[model samples]
Target: MGICSIKQMTTRKLLVLSTIHQISVLLLSDALTVSETSPDAPNSDDTTSINHPRNLATEALYINQNFRRMVLKRNEEPFKYDNPRLPFDEGDTDADSCVAYKYRSWYLGRQADGTEVRLICRTEHDGVTTGPNGETQMLTIKAFNEWDSRMASGVDWRSKLDTQKGAVLATELQNNSCKLAKWTLQALLAGSDQIKF
Candidate 1:
């Protein structure tokens, strides 16, 4: 859209468009921050703005899609719904033939400097979606937490030598005890396909 000024455009949409055009730009936002719609639309950058405290299932869905290369399915013309440019950026995930999932992972995190900053994040995807051929495709994502907080080998977490004989999951669980608890609680409340998880 040459009509829209760069300052007036949503960075998320701009990145998607840029990726399509093979342009280089830093992505400072989550991939699925919103419904891939218009910048001025009420829900343009909307993140699960409903009455819930938070939800992240949809972000997991996009991650799963990217991993599965289901994003390639978006190259199909019929799938090109929201983007003004196509043949490059993956198109919208159609809700008519599948579940239209939404997400919310807006939160506050402390930086290395101990300053709290807002960050967009990812979470979960609860159910299955149908493909164009009516094939049932299940989206299961395990965004596992590694124990290291971007820390060096010796400091924040125990050295590899120290934990060499311990169970890996146990060490991670110890370092991310509260994070694991929160993730478990979210998965339980979401009633997601644990078998899929």
Candidate 2:
């Protein structure tokens, strides 16, 4: 098999594995929800306000459950890559390629803290020519909020700034890097920033 063919196979396998794992997690979560088998308690005659924490909790439970389903669906979609023909075979010449792909989703709501968290994940694939074979490297970036006991105690929200700031900074870096790398190459070859030019 040619170098590009081998690389294509490896990428296809990665995509399939990622998709299957995502689906399995969704199915498992669904099964857990249904198998609990706890009968719902009868509604009480006393009705206060819908804004109560208990009512909010019940609503949040359903929203979160549905959010997970949406996440799985989005992740399964094929992301744009620098090499549009990627995961494609290059007949021979040991091609040199660089590809970057990213996926992002955001949720805005109060969860103990007033600030909302943004979820993001990005993956980069870089392949270089080495003699008769092609060597490709894949790197992934994942970020989520972490609980900080110290911040939870302080009155000022700035105490938790580092954590939130870190996530934002990482996301910005990835976005900028991918844009720069893709554009730089296009400029070198086409003498312009436009991909088609």
Who wins the lDDT comparison?
Answer: 1
Model 1 per-residue lDDT tens digits across residues 14-114: 87887866632232222222111212212213555431112233443355455534433454443322332322235654423332233445447888999
Estimated TM-score for each candidate: 0.28, 0.18
Off by over 4 Å in 1: 1-140, 145-166, 193-197
lDDT tens digits, residue span 163-193, model 2: 5766444433343354335435533332221
Per-residue error for 118 in candidate 2, Å, reads 37
Off by over 4 Å in 2: 1-48, 74-197
lDDT of 1 at 155: 27
